[model samples]
Target chain A: MNDVTGMPQTAVVIGGGSDIALATLRLLAKRRLRAVVLLGRSAEALNEAAEQLRGAGVEEVTTEIFDVNDFSHASEVAEETVARLGTVDLVLVAAGFLGDASLEVIDPESVAHMIATNFTGPAAAMTAFSQRLLRQGFGRIVVLSSVAGVRVRRSNFVYGSAKAGLDGFAQGLDDALVKTGLSVMIVRPGFVHSKMTLGLKAAPMSTTPEAVAGAIVKGLESGASVVWAPSSLMWVFGILVHLPRRLWRLVPG
Target chain B: MIPGDTDAFVGWGNNNATRAVHRRPRNTKEIAALLEGSSMCIARGLGRAYGDAAQCAGGTVIDCTGLSEILAFDGSSGVVRVEAGCSLDQLSRYSVSRGWFVPVTPGTAFVTIGGAVAADVHGKNHHREGSIAGYIEELCLVTPDGPRIVGPDRDPELFWATCGGMGLTGVITEVALRLMPIATSYLSVDTDRARDLDACMEMLASGDERYRYSVAWIDAGTRGRALGRAVITRGDHARVEALAGTQRSIPLTYNPVQRLSVPFTPPVSMVNALTLPVFNSLWYHRAPKHRTDEIQTMSAFFYPLDMLRDWNRLYGPRGFTQYQMVVPFGQEHVVRYTIERLQEASCPSTLGVLKRFGAGDPAPLSFPMPGWTLALDIPLGSPSLAVALDDCDRHVAGAGGRVYLAKDGRMRPELMREMYPRIDQFLETCHRTDPDGLFVSDLSRRIGLTPTTPTQRKGMKP
Candidate 1:
């Protein structure tokens, strides 16, 4: 009944309550992924997300309290989830922040918080999970990287900078997993329409969590190194990333 | 815990949009979990049902599209096990490439297998084959109690009940279907022009069995002596040797390119009273008076509408209603009367199709029987459209015919009971399987099916 890769039967979703994370989980479940461990900040949101996953036909869903800002606990979270789910075949990390861009200029603590929430803690969790996957000798990891991180825009530089660091971390991790029976796929989505961006004016080529989920699943199925939601954004950002400093500053967030 | 997005959903016909909580279940466990938790919910696949059969107002609507996957395919036997959410279009293209085809398919290939099973849909080949239910080897359904595998020989009542059950019996998760083997992806067709209703009926009655598939396109706008003028077409799969030229090299390649599309819904419908006669006249004359062994792609023969994606938007924002009904062979006058009534009512229906169904399946609520089935796609801008359709309903019921539940939106409960003589039996079976009335849809409620009452709810849930 399983597809070519035998359809991943176990998975772990970091930042599980986030729209893109939950969407990716649903896509995985469709591929017959049986067991999942959801790690998220809000207990209420995690419970609701687990219920939703159950409705979407995931056989077993376990949620644990997690905060991406809690850097010291990141590795523990990964270890515990892996121990609980057992032999996780897929790990999807969609933990990040889109905090006020101006906060970096006003306070150092705010800048640190943004970096910890978006980069440090998530990177720690991925590092822990990556080691476990290598020991198991077969697994896939998908991390949600934003187009904003492709080339940090001044309007949201603080948030973009953290994603920039995480994006680079994912790329390095992907290279390190070469031929190790493990793989990493970094998803770059531009202006996603989600609860986090509800009130914000939508940017051109804005995609949905479902769209990003589709890209991630397609990447996993094809064993692609990276995926871009609304794929055109890959080229758009490719050219935009190389723009001269003066011209790039004029570009909106 | 994962609450679904509550929104208004409309059928293919953009009419009767009802608010419901839409949950797309990725697996059977999720579907079962939703069924267990939701007070009321109905399983929907692709939302291709022309009316509200897939919608549950103020309740949960489980979107089964996420469950789409071809589990297994035996090319030798032409048997395929697929998730119910797999569309006929998907299966046809996949199987046809392997020298196999779905046993029965509706005009639009966009319909999901779950919808096809729930509706008991028939195709142009009904005279030779039967409805989709006949081809279904087994069905794995998530009932109120749990999962159950039902087949014709085992649990025949539940099997028949689930067929054309309109998602009332349960959420169909997996279906094992027996596919028809074909030599090529093209159809060798014979076309003939019928001058009137009698000529059309005569052609279908006498010549249908000669070919594997047959259907007629009646010009509903024609009146008086020309009433029911039609272009009758009969076809069979073109053998590899039949293709004389370049097509012989790759006989089984499926036609997948959809070259045309309607990007957006126009402010007003393109199909209206003013456009009917001109379009009908042009269409009727376009076909040759008589053509034999004309080769056409399977898409051209089975799914011409699919060529232009989102063609339904042509009916405009109000959308269109498909009134498909079947009248027994003895009551052929009802078909004629219904066509005349549409003409009098000034309801310009496009693509008025007439096909003869050969035999009825064991499914009690299945739509097809040994009869003449006429389907009409009438745009829904006219104020008198509902009344005219209801009037036709009575005429059909009087003739021992019934309106298709899949195509119904405004049918009365009493009339439905009258049309379906075995409603009591269908209800009794539903009670035994889904006594709690958890599997409810807008169509079921509108027609007084699975009425939530103290007696019905007895020994059901806390």
Candidate 2:
């Protein structure tokens, strides 16, 4: 359950190995988070993250093998996890793939994999969790979206489009669950420096994983449906999204 | 018009407003109709509860206030059968003039009879009279299964469950309550000022038994040697002979009206850190050090805050949360520890009240017990308010105490089982009464009161 400050006591991270998810869980542990269940495709990474969370003061930390692409078992895993935890205050969807856009444009197989990892798989998992959460009566879901999805750019249209699909899905889910004691929050970071973007050129307003985690924590406390990493990205995208396509393409990454 | 109107509803605290479909059912037939088709629903009265106990998010909120009719009243026997919507204010206006009053009332009279029953509200007289559950003879409940009458003797399981069930069992349509007979609408009161926590507790423990009603106003701002300094007030219904000069002619007069109201919410809380200490000091110092045999109106003694309509808005747009908890007789130290922790966290509380509760009834979820209960109103603006309250909850639960569900908007689900040891029994009764799980409220869902597994209802489908 979430406390008076809306800080979740127990959380389930779908992509437990994601840098931002681990950082957010660490920060939440400092703010009264007691238990967590980390689910990911890699058993070793999930176990490592669970150990780190336990060390950070989370009383209970468990790991489960989860492959988002296996849509058949998504709902089953959600039910099992909820049964194990008794009540989950939060379910964070932080799984995504940033494929090489240059090669993905021509590689149909890679494109399918990217779309499955970034959009379809996470959506399936969230939908399943939503059913369980609605039945249990109260819980929140936070999905890691991106500013890139706010307006798909020429540089990374494939990854941006996948995130765009997820952003729209989450927004619609939030509205559908209105007054149901269930909510969905979307986090849009301009550019987060993490394992996924280690050698990438830093965007103009790029932020660190810890900053993004801080914003997510604050967003949860404020009951915000959408949060921007630097917060200024809300306005930056307000104008950038409306720019002429020719000019939008010319804007640097 | 099936679901009635769609609007935002909030508890008295004015926080966490949820948009719900509101239905005003005029009779049991209509209520039964609403219950049959709705996936989830809960009855709402005057919304006096400070938290989410009354509001069901995204679900149907049957506004029982429409059923505001006094069906039967035997003035001689001091018993009244009223529609669940009938507010205590209305009941008092009708009954007090006829030498009768509600057996139990919280700080306010605006709450409905059904709400009083649902929360099993207790007044300052709880030390002697117990909660409203003791006075509730029967109730007309409309559940998904259908409408039926329940009482202490008939369907006692369901009756006790509904007492403090937080409206999870079903929608209450009517209540048969036993009122208290009174000679006049005035109280012979006494006041005493205590210098510290021990003195206040000692005075209450030693002298409270002599009075029918007792409560203490603790100054939370005071710390160190002066910590928990309080002004205690104790009283009993004044006899007609105690009335002064002209008042004797019509001693039962009960025309209590709102003297002042907060017209609108201010931009910032009026009861903030800057002004709270000043208010506390003035409130503490203004009281008579020791006074006795003072004739006071019943309204003045019982519901002074009722004189100011929407007084909750004084906390401003962010609103405030009332932390009310009860620890058993031997666990009085938790009361002082809570105040100390609040002060240490710099959480300025505007109002602090202390009362002693007698042995609790059979209701598993009922709040009061043979213990000391303290209630404090803290503005939501305090940064450490949540942590401080959580810390208090841990200690209170460790001491076998529980916070009042009617006043709780924020509490962890894990601690609920620890706080209310019989919560599983209450849930079992809820499941048996409404197996489909049609009745629910935001508070129920937030605290994990709703059934967690589908397996719990496997063999019970009738």
Candidate 3:
């Protein structure tokens, strides 16, 4: 059922992921939607996530190996999720880099591969998810963004630029699904110190993944076309995206 | 409330008197406007009825009586133009004065023309003139789609449906039927005392061939051999010349004093065993043993109760129920067993009538048939009553018979589905006519007549 028009209603979470996507999945299941197919890169990793969902009381889950960079297996994982379960209710594209920004300069190839895995691969995954959502005449595409995308803070423009493109694409798709009751909510988080950003300093009033999950649940309930993380960032970015060129160059990376 | 009828007894299952909201619309256009986007609905006539047939619970009810109007009449052809709301009593008074009468009339004159057509109400002469539908020439029904006139040669399915449609399809607005020509405004009558139930049925059916009107009044409380014993009254419209010289000079006027009701209810026990038995005995004893007499007026012969005002209140707090079921010819055992059970239970019945009908009109849902029909007037308040008769409905169904939709209340949806296989067809027509499901009624809701609501499709559930 992972074809263009249908996706497994079940979803599996790969990696020890953020709580936002899982919280969203649990909400969908409450409405009696079936199948939450979860796929992580490692057997143990997928098992741990499944255990956490079961502990969290999520009723439906499917898991398999799905490494973002492992192209051959990653595509197969998407196929197998649909095969085992059925059409998907939603696709949480919540897997990608909060990698070492400096590693890219030391190894250009790593930077290029990160860009490929971070942007290109997810784009391919989204293409597949979109086909399924449209065919079913319903679906939600939730992709995470970072405040870093607010401006290329040259320090992590590679990640920021990729989010910029993803954010733009998600918004356009949201517009397309207006009357169909389907939508996309690209969440842009401000800097925070997490496992993803181990050494990074927390920004002012920065929120935890718990806060982000709460925000996403509220947004979905309100049938919002889109939602911003730390909601104040919506206005902050509104100013940042149009900052004066001379002042923008002076802002810290 | 009629005797021994539990299904017709509970007009509102939730017997909150606050629920009785009497709506009065001014005219047919208002009714037409109400039909928009109806999910489901049934039309209601006068609340004079003792059952839910004319009382839809929570849906649109077009009070067709608001459209009551006498549009035209051709004295030469005996054809009358009237709104569906025109009452049988009103029509009778108007036409009978001018030498015309309805072809068929139920015991009461308070029923509307549309109600008559909807129930296809038969009369003592049903074995002769058939049901009211036979006299119906054309009907304008506000169908699922909109108002459309249906005649036999027109929308035949709808024509058949509207005759006994019970307002499920839509409100019936105007009707054009041929008024019957009468010899005079009087009836020459004959009364025969029936020895038993069989003799009662025999006397009623056999006398029907000779007389235009025939009915049997059973002494409801009498048991065993006397059970089902009745007085068969048969009559023919009397010409002015047939009346004795002096009696022919009597005036033709509406009775100012008809049924003087029992003022305030006498209490719940008023209609119970002892008193009803006494009353039944008195009624039976009071009838003339075997008399041939001249009846002064057609209304007296046909609609003796038309003179009554607020008669429904006679049933007290829990209104009376009219339990009428057909036990087709061969299944005489059901009728016999039923009467025996009623005898055992000692259910008090005041007015018990027995009549026979010819095969009913083609209106697929019409209730009258070529079988025996017995109706009783029971005072309300009996929980076990419905359960008992529903067993009777089941037995009747098993014997290839059915209860009238126009008089039903407690029937289950499954039974309705089994009995009227064409109900779905009626629903489909409603859907097409009112796509948004604007029309809905209490009876439809009570009987599993539900309309599908819009829900989010598949995933991304909203």
- lDDT of candidate 2 at residue A101, scale 0 to 100: 89
Query: On a 0 to 100 scale, what is the lDDT of residue A5 in model 3?
Result: 11
Report the lDDT tens digits of candidate 1 across residue range B299-334: 899888889998889988667878899999999999
Per-residue C-alpha lDDT of model 1 across residues A180-218, encoded as one tens digit per residue: 545678999999999888888788999999998877776
RMSD of 1: 15.9
How many clashing residue pairs are found in candidate 1? Answer: 6
> Candidate 1 regions off by >4 Å?
A1-253, B1-4, B452-462
Give me the runs in candidate 2 sitting further than 4 Å from their true place: A1-3, A9-17, A26-193, A197-215, A222-253, B1-7, B381-383, B452-462
- TM-scores of the candidates are 0.64, 0.79, 0.60
Fnat values, one per model, are: 0.00, 0.11, 0.00
Per-residue alpha-carbon lDDT of model 3 for A1-253, expressed as tens digits? 1101111234544343545555555554433234466754557756766676776556666676666666555555655554454334456777667656754353777777767656666666766555444433334566776777667765676787777776777777767655342456677777654556667766675876666765665554333445677888889888888988888767764
Error of 2 at A233 (Å): 12
When just chain B is superposed on the true chain B, each candidate scores a TM-score of 0.96, 0.97, 0.88
Candidate 3 docking quality: incorrect, acceptable, medium or high: incorrect
For model 1, state the Cα shift of residue B129 in Å. 1.0
Looking at model 2, the pairs that clash are: none
**All candidates' lDDT scores?**
0.82, 0.87, 0.63
